[model samples]
Target: MINLHWVILLPIILGTIVKLISIKTAKKIMVLFQSALLISATMIFIEVRKNGTVLENIGGWPDTIGITLRADLLASVMVLLTCFLFLAMIIFVHNKNYADHLFFFLFLSLESLIIGIFLSNDLFNIFVLIEAATLIITVLIMYKKANVAIYDGMMYLLINVVAMSFFLMGLGMLYKKIGVLDFYALETALSQVKDPQSLILPYAFMITAVSLKAALMPLFSWLPKAHGTPSAPSVVSAILSGLYVKTGIYVFLRLQIAFSPLIDTSELFVILGLITAIVGFILALAQKDIKLLLAYSTVSQIGVIMIGINLDNPMAYWGGLYHLMNHAIFKSTLFLTAGMIISEYQTRNLAEINGVFKHMPAVGVATILSILGIIGAPLFNGSISKYLIASGSSGTWIESGLILVNLGTIIVFIKYGQLLFGSSGKKETADSDILEKAVVLTLSMLCFLGGIFGSELIAILFNVKLTVDRLSYSIKILLFIGSIFLGILIYRGLFKKTNRLAFITSFELGFNEICLSITLFFAFMVAYLKLTL
Candidate 1:
């Protein structure tokens, strides 16, 4: 029988070859093969769940020497989610005029690369897969012929490539000292070396690199430009926000396991995360463009994950990981809904676009449910993860940080939710869009039900002991209510008083990135001095 690992690679290889046939057929392959792969991903995901991690070595080589496919519970969950989002995107793209076959093909290539990244135990493999993903996405963002798309994509590529280079250099340094590039191998080397400083340079390199990808700060400049301006098919919206950005969390988890020597950086992560959360929300609140608002919101949500990583408790990791899932689910829903809104009407400014729900009631309901989910309102998916991420932090100084995150998200969504009911939800006449309605209804269901079943979902994906205390529930309720109240106050009080500014061009954007890079370099030097001679 063919190995399931081999089974997974079959389509990727076929896709590479398909382009020689016809661009039209190549584009269609994303729709065709991803459907089969989705089914296969489900079956394997279930199998991996029951039997423990699956290790598939290519060319029948042993695990340590050969390229290996390692599917742990983490990979199973992430890759399955990737496939689901990809399929949903295919449906969203079905009727649109794709610029070329490359767009369609890249979708699967990206899907496969993401699967490969999650499933690979080898660090080098992850790098290759990640680079592949970055290349594909960069090209996708600039799929059009215009300069805005081209310039934005170029900036994204340059920054990401620099980050990726730093990460590689760090890996090379680690490999030089340890002669191994796999996570398990690195763990063994880390333990045997005894010189904790053996990893100062490499550890420093990777943290900075991954932080860039994860959009932790300073490294996050590309996120707004890349994601906010993409063609943003509904499913792609879901995947980029929900699945792609979470790779940083995966890197952090792996770092914890492999670079235990550098565990001290957890505190640093916490401080930087707090900074990121506050700055990101403030920037988000300042935006006039709706996509940019959501883009800044992405920065804030990632800050939430960093808090969990920095908190570094098993429970904190649990919450961080849990929020990882929730953010991906709801943020994707919001972005996709944003795409449909743009398609139905023609504007992306929250102030300009209104009464969309009137024309497309399903989109309206989806928008409302996604808003509720994002705000962590009662019984929606966003609340569960929000509680974990918040509970993952202390209820004191840092807790206020999480509250700010909620309030910022609520600020933007309320702007949209209120708009859908007013003068903007429709044009001259309110007409029903059955196709648009169906898509929105599907996502809206996920948004609502994800919250309702969050606890069970958490248990199924992660083995951490998670308990929902009454106090936890009460705090979340209070935070949600307080955020809504504050949003209203801010809208009435400050929004009317504030002027519009683009976070993208501001000095603050560069300031955050420079601060992050300086911090990472400083941490690296200190680690080197302390660990080495």
Candidate 2:
């Protein structure tokens, strides 16, 4: 097996070599490199599963003294997913003429950093990885050199830089107190403290950065600009929405686990998650730009995933992880297919382009399947995850809140589903790119299979047996069907005819406002932790 450090380094090494080669040679080398990376990731995952956790210290130093690379089940799964998504992205972009050696270099560098984030066992190392990845992503976002793209890319960079400063401050505070930056060592130190208040400031600072990274509530202003920038390549948007955003969620999980012994933030996050979800869908409903719609939908889905993860139930926690994987599948497909549609139709406006079923049947079918998957249709991957999440909140107001979130999801997608119907005033043609079609259709199929085999998937991915009560599942199905109808009525009656929700689009936040939100969020976290203690 390859050394774990090599897994993080090989991509950048290969990527730089490709930049000096011809474009055609670069593509061939990339395919080979990605295949090798995927193989290595699979082996690493299997090894982790069989042996429990794998740890490697740099330069043979002790775990507490050296920067360590750790691969537990969560890290392995994330690494595996990152490699798989990168492969899909390369395949999706193969036929496009614009993808060059420099593009491949930056893309591969981002891949390496993302994998590094997943494997790093030191908080400072993870922080450095995140900052590097941000700069690379900004470059990719502005690759086309358009004015608007540059503006949005810079905005994204500035926001993250501000957020990372908070992360660095928190890291320094923790190190000052404990004299160690390693995750394991820091967790051990934090656990020994009797008073939670001592660490509350550091927790607030770090979690504020995390909240922004995760795009929760007011902090989400950066996401639509980053993910939906018209000048950014669709593959860039796909990778950003699909795999990159999950890095924050992964860190959130890891950090929360470290603090779990001293403080409980489940109730706080549950409330924040619900609010974020509602706000996400409301803004999504106001979008006309297809990419922006998908971007905002991502914010909503992140909120749903947060709710599931913080429900304080084991089933819900696992369910949230499952949904994270599922979101990557379908959202990537949606963005990839949206790019195809925009290419063919010469527009990004949802109302202006239609008849996808006739103009490009394969793309349309893939898009529809992904939509169904996202909306939690009974036979799709989302249903199983939502079911598990719902099971955790049984007979509570939170349960009803989950239903309301589902209904809002359905309504939001109902507007997006408009793309599949009506004539585009063009002749029908089959989608010709074999590689792109294959990647999209495969993901769409997985959405279906994920639902049907979700119980088994949870067992495989998490090593926990998941049993579903048939009666409860049947009732869930009924609720899903009713929600669909209600969503349709609401969409037609409220969303279709009125400008009531249009004002939501006008509620934009400037950078100063966004920074203020972060300050307030940090203050609130400190207050909450104090009260709970």
Candidate 3:
């Protein structure tokens, strides 16, 4: 039997060893290592799918005393996604001449930490890995060493360190109560507790930290700065927006399950998700920088995913997971393409750079497909996921709220699509190479096929059977079309007329304010759980 734990260890070991070699040699070895890692991750996914969960105890010690690593369906799927994304990122940056051995080393180290987070069954291990990943990401974000990048990296590092302190405090609380750190054991201990309410404080502390990591609502102030730092490389932005943010969501899911027996805060999360979705889009609409626009869009999509997961509906939960993967694909493509466009134009302003179709047809087409997926256009991946989520809605309020969110998303993208047309006579300097084009085209094709075979893909991925309702499908198409028209109208009638609203784009909270928001959010969650549970 293959020790699944080795899957996590191999990358870290190779990353460390690569530091001893020259840059060119390290790049070659890193590529080979990533390829092997992807294969190992795929094998793990297949084994888990065929034979159920895999578990390993470190040093062959007993579960009670030793650390445990486990790979269930969710963890396996996440591992596979992480590996594939890392491979794509490696290829995306391969030709950029930025292949410093240290860069590849840190990149691989970050990859290892991410996989560890997904597979580890111990709370302390998760905390350590998250903290390590945060440090590696800060370094990567400021790799170019520009002034703004340094500030962004510092802010990211500080905020996350504070957040992880809460996580550590919660770990201490859990140990004080349960005497076990393994997740399964913690779950058992939580279930045996005579008064589950006593676990509320630890839960509040831990979840508040996870919420900050996930960039929920007011706690999201750090995400835009980190993801859209002006000096950071585009691939850095892509990875942060695509893979890194999902870590927070993954942690949130795990923490919820670990605490499931003690409390149910799904309703509270659902409400907060709605608020985040609305606020995120509103902020996104006010952004002129293309990357910042996409970053805020990510915040909005994260909100939607949060709502779907917490809705107490299996279909909605599945939809949310699917959307999570879909968002990673499309959003990464957008950021990568945006980086290319920005490079060619030497500017980040969306309104200033027009005629993408004429300048970069392949990239423009890929961008359009991604935008369609994002807006939930018919026969696209977003539409299928949104439909599944909508199918599970029970109340008029839920449906109406979803419609409003969709409208907001559509409006934001409609504004984004402006860059696709209108000729600009200036020639672009940074040409797309074959590898870049291939990556974009491959991702764009997935966006289309993911929608075309949405049900099959869902079944294969999650092993959940779901049937599409013809009537509901037709209605959703109509709604999508209507939303597009409404979005365009709103863009013309309202957005173009608003100059005062740009103040929101410039409005930012400092570290102290963000900490206060975390505290306030924690208090609000504790009160809600006290009342509801």
Q: Per-prediction TM-score, please?
A: 0.90, 0.98, 0.97
TM-score rank order: 2, 3, 1
Q: Which runs of model 2 end up more than 4 angstroms from their true locations?
A: none
- Residue 379 displacement in candidate 2 (angstroms): 2.0
- Candidate 3 at 331: error in angstroms? 0.8
How well is each residue in 1-533 modelled by candidate 3, as lDDT tens digits? 45777778888788789889877777678778888888888888888889999998889999858879999998989898888888888888877776577787788888889899999998899999999999999998899999999999999999999889988998999899899988888888888988877888889999999998888887899999899998788888988998889999999998899888878889888888888999999999999999999999999999999988999899999999999999988999999999888887888998888998788888898999999999998899999998988877756477788899999999999888888888867666336887787888788878899899999988978879888888889989998888888888989988865633588976799999988988898888778778877
For every candidate, C-alpha RMSD to the true structure in Å: 3.2, 1.1, 1.5
Relative to the unseen true structure, what is the C-alpha lDDT of residue 169 in candidate 1, on a scale of 0 to 100?
Answer: 88
Candidate 1 displacement at residue 116 in angstroms: 0.7
Ranking 1 against 3 by lDDT, winner:
3
CA shift of 483, model 3, Å: 0.2
lDDT of 1 by residue, 119-177 (tens): 88898888888888888887777776467777777777777777888789888998889
Candidate 2 lDDT tens digits, 272-342: 98999988998888988999999999999999999999998887888889999999999999999999888
By summed lDDT, the worst window of 10 consecutive residues in model 3 runs over 424-433
**Order of candidate numbers by lDDT, starting with the best:** 2, 3, 1
Each prediction's total of clashing residue pairs, residues at least 3 apart in sequence or on different chains, is: 12, 0, 0
Q: What is the lDDT of residue 376 in candidate 2?
A: 95
